[model samples]
Target: MKVIDTVLNVLWLLLCGIWMALGYFLAGIVCCIFIITIPFGIASFRIAGYVLWPFGRTTVERPDAGAPSCVGNVIWLVFAGWWLVLAHIATAIALAVTIIGIPFAWANLKLIPISLMPLGREVVSTDEKFGGR
Candidate 1:
């Protein structure tokens, strides 16, 4: 089940494999230029662990706190976010071209929001989500 599989992944991320997660965090950090994109930058750092190890971490869509970082985040999306989205789209296309890569492509798509403006988003573990289910 997707739930079970996703939970397993959250556990892995809390471990010592943080370096692997840094790759995503670093990408996000690069986009944090100007004050507007700071939230996204912070968000990216927050989700780096999940991006690094999605299987062991869990992603749940949360309600946006209503214009949490609007101006800055918007500017960020216009600049670097679009490029990251474009890159992810390209990778998805390449993976979709092959049947075996569909899953990876699907997972990559999930990274969009966090890849864009990570501010106001929270990445939690399975245990935290289900109260230790």
Candidate 2:
């Protein structure tokens, strides 16, 4: 990751990433309680890691991921995703209130879509944009 991305990520982790990741972790735990929801649980955990230090990473649709992921995402959204989205929005509002936190607030808003539909997405390094992984 670039120096700027690293700095932004560290700041984000301090200001909002920890709380957002915790939200995802809690959602993952809930999803894991049932056998049928294990996939959603896994996806939630994956998203949790991405939320932790998000500045240098971006989410892309996985070409090989199929219908099951879509179905799981719907179930996830109905069950726990909405609450996480609300949390993100609330956090964004709080962060936006401070000048220093404005960038983090934007990052928080960027996470809402993934919070709502995490399946079928893979987090890749921004360096991949330059043909390197």
Off by more than 4 A, model 1: 1-23, 31-39, 61-66
* Candidate 2, lDDT over the whole model: 0.90
TM-score of 2: 0.94
TM-score of each: 0.63, 0.94
Best by lDDT: 2
Residue-wise C-alpha lDDT for candidate 1, range 14-120, written one tens digit per residue = 33224435655665677477475566667666666666667645666567755755565677677656776776677667667777667667776877776676555
lDDT against the true structure, each candidate: 0.63, 0.90
Error of 1 at 17 (Å): 13
Model 1 RMSD vs true structure: 5.3
Give a tens-digit lDDT track for model 2, residues 13-128.
Answer: 89988998999999889889999888889999999999998988889899998998898889888999899999999999999999998888888998999999899999988777
List the lowest-lDDT window of 10 residues for candidate 1.
Answer: 11-20
